[model samples]
Target: MKQRLIILSDLCGSEKSDWLIYYTHILNQKYDLVYYDSCQLGNVDTSSNDQQIIHQQFVEGGIRKAISQLIELEQNPIKILAFSIGGLIAWRYGLLTGNIKSLICISSTRLRKEVYKPKGEIELYFGEKDAYRPPMEWFINQNVKFEVIPNKHHEIYTEREFAEEFSLKLCNIQSH
Candidate 1:
């Protein structure tokens, strides 16, 4: 059986970004990939049609739902790739659920206290120019591997080449 990979996108979800397409291609080469768009999974109220409101809903409700889904899927340990606010969700969720085999986060802030330490390895990628970089203490205490992508923003991994390289790294983690 192939390994599983769950990818969580940022505020606007997978449709708004290219991360899904690129990463899915790479993961599909070696694993069965599952894509979860945080906005859609949480079923946040979008009646107002405001981007900020939608994003807020993702932070408040979507993250929780995403974590619950991951926990429910724990029968099959999977590698998770999260971007931006999605990364924040993954961190908190991983700490709480402790089911993922590995995690790769991009340009995310540490917003909540960690309740569960990850049993799997964690890789965090951040841009030097991103505004939301967390304090050194946060990363240092978590023991997460950090990578600085040059000239990247909050959405650095959205690029096809970047996603491909990232997916390869994720696959390697599962193999080892």
Candidate 2:
């Protein structure tokens, strides 16, 4: 049987996210993929496109709600490919439930607020230009592996080239 890989979307969820094809097309061939929309999981209102409004909703209560909902839905070990706010949800899930096999977080700037690290094979990627990305000291203190992609910004994961390259790298890692 193929390994299971869970994909958690960014705050935008599936709305206007054609870029997801860049990763899904490649990852589907090697794993049994399960996709989750962050907004739906968190019960965030996405009627408006204002990022600030959406982000505020998540900050108020959505993130916690999503984590709880995900824990209730997934009980077994999981490997996660999460973007932005989705990464934060996965991190909290791993911390609370502790069954993550591996976690790859892309552009999860909000992680700067976290102090404790979860137990898992964790990899974090951030754009060098993303001001909200956690400082190098945070990574060192957490003992987590991280990479800063040069000349990129917060939404770097949306790029097709980056998605393809990242999917290739993910395929090489053995999942349990």
Runs in model 2 deviating more than 4 A are 173-176
lDDT for 57 (candidate 2): 95
Q: Which residues of candidate 1, in runs, are more than 4 Å off? A: 46-50, 73-76, 110-117, 171-176
Clash pairs detected, candidate 2: none
Maximum-lDDT candidate: 2
lDDT of 1 at 83: 76
* Candidate 1 lDDT for residue 12: 74
lDDT of 1 by residue, 60-157 (tens): 77768866765665545568878777776676666676666788777665442553456687888887667677666777887778877777776677
The alpha-carbon lDDT assigned to residue 86 of candidate 2 equals 97
Q: For model 2, what is the C-alpha lDDT against the true structure?
A: 0.93
Pairs in clash, predicted candidate 1? none
TM-score versus the correct structure, for each prediction: 0.80, 0.96
